[model samples]
Target: MSTPSPTMPPWPAESDHASGWSLVRAAAAAAEAAAAANRPARYALVAATGLLRELAPEEEGGLLAWEPGTGWRCLLPPQDCRQAVADLYLPLCAAHAARPITVAHLGQSLDGFIATGGGDSYYVTGPANILHLHRLRALCDAVVVGAETVLTDNPRLTARLATGPNPLRVVLDPSRRLPATHHVFSDGAASTVRACLAPNAAFTPGAADLVVAERGGRLDLADLVRQLRARGCSRIFIEGGGVTVSAFLQAGLLDRLQVAIASLLIGEGRPALMLPGREPLAHCVRPAARLFRMGEDILYDCDLAASTAAPAAAAPNGQSLQRLF
Candidate 1:
């Protein structure tokens, strides 16, 4: 994959670093510059000094860091910036020093549809939500999607709108049906991985790698996650077309999920998060969520780890009761 551009916004002086947003931007820019220069991107918040410090691999001390589900913590007693950090980018930074972090996101209309009857979904959410997605791509190691997403949106899967290293693009085409002319495979903007049941010899996966995983005519989602983790992709982002995101969520593999609800309504189309029917409200997956406003869209950041078991309610024929948010 090509290295990102070195040009980035100038960081405010250390004394002027009062806002959490500014600190996050500075850290993200530094990490991108490190990647561009072929160096390790190591950064953290020093607990005692209350400063965002760049550290060497061997360095150890009172550093504040975040982990999935557990939130941010420090070696020593932390300063008063925890709330500020958490409010801005602590969730994204969870992958910084952690491993096997998998997150999923889906954008749908008020009517619970991702696309129209004919499958035409271009800008469901506004620019702010789009930027949030780009930021997710920027922070993660790999971005994943399913075959239908490749056939429909044909997304680039790059952090083009944000400042960071572009993540590896992963397309899960279990049947090997996607044409290699798709942007993720042919663009060469970022490294791509095609996960399928078998390799089609005739199809040139230009600048892309191939991985195979199947079980009883289905792609093994767990196996795919293991393979990605083995490849040093500790952080994975499931950026999708409805079905793909739904599959991950159903598998109970997602640590966090961000569902963006747009104001528009697509009455009959591809729905998001199609899970099994659950009759009882108690058996439903009720996760702890934080709401964030993104232009006209309202994003529900749900912590899947903190949620109750999602084995579906015991009641019969209660499919409509399983909706989240």
Candidate 2:
């Protein structure tokens, strides 16, 4: 619990307390504004701390503040702010302030399947995880998904469940196979980018931004990140169906990877990650992680960038895990 500040004034009578969701919305607004100005989003949050203070009046006591260097902390007591909310989100806020970040997230069963063999993946986690995904979209400048996800789900890729602006939608369809009629390409809810290896003449102008990547055996992931960054999408979210997220991870492009493990089991289906296997446990990628319980789901928020930058640590015995690629 946080203690009340002796010197700070109480919250205004007109705005006594703010709901956690309200704060989430406010943070999203700040991030959106920051992206528009091409500045680190955390600066906006810092500038608005005074305004946020009103949500947690000194008398009532429960305030949360996030800094790039120090991370999240309470300025006043009772620590009324929801810890789960802060734990789940503050890293994202910090990521915005630190540098351009590429994050990938997936929800899977305890057995590691994202869906059944027949492709039925309606609710792997619970409502809370779904809302968390929406919050992820709300906080990012762009949300990416592979062609299979588009063909399978036809998702709108909007932050409809959360109180924030919809993110720019990006579809990773290397072959340009997804039809223009999909909701992401046709709905016009937000600007959409169709990234492919070749331009499809069938797509009409303004249908969506057509980004033709350099022709390799596959789309160049690094070049793709550069192009997206050039377009001012500094915070990218890879919301996916495994293969695409795995590709980014293998290419060492992901800054963070979040996987929500549900209590149920799919027994056998598509795996959550498809990385090459390491014969020894010490050779596996061991990222720094923080865990959060969301209803029935357990989210393992892995810090890939931190793990990759730091020196490899010794495992349980004398052996050390392989350095992240």
Best prediction by lDDT: 2
**lDDT (0-100) at residue 157 of candidate 2?**
91
**Candidate 1: Cα lDDT at 157:** 90
Per-residue lDDT for 1-325 in model 1, tens only?
A: 2232121112223233234444454443333233334433345765464446756668775244433344344332323333333353555554432335788988999989988877788888888778778878977889999888888888899999876679989888876678889998898899888887777666665644456577668788988888888787767899987888888888888989999999998898888889898868767777867666555677888888788745435533333433222
Q: After superposing candidate 1, which stretches have Cα over 4 Å from the reference? A: 1-22, 25-51, 54-88, 96-98, 207-209, 309-325
Alpha-carbon shift of residue 74 in model 2 (angstroms): 4.8
Provide the lowest-lDDT 10-residue window in model 2. 6-15
Q: How good is model 1 by TM-score?
A: 0.73
Q: What TM-score do all the candidates reach, one by one?
A: 0.73, 0.77
- Give per-residue CA lDDT, model 2, range 1-325, as digits (tens): 2343322222212122224455554544444333444521222123344234323223333355444344444343434443346445655654443367788999999899898887788989888789889888988888999898889888999999876779888898887777788898888889888888877667744355456556448888888888888787767999998999998999999989999999887987877899998766655667888666565677889998656434456543353432211
**How high a TM-score does candidate 2 get?**
0.77
Which lDDT value does model 1 have at 58? 83
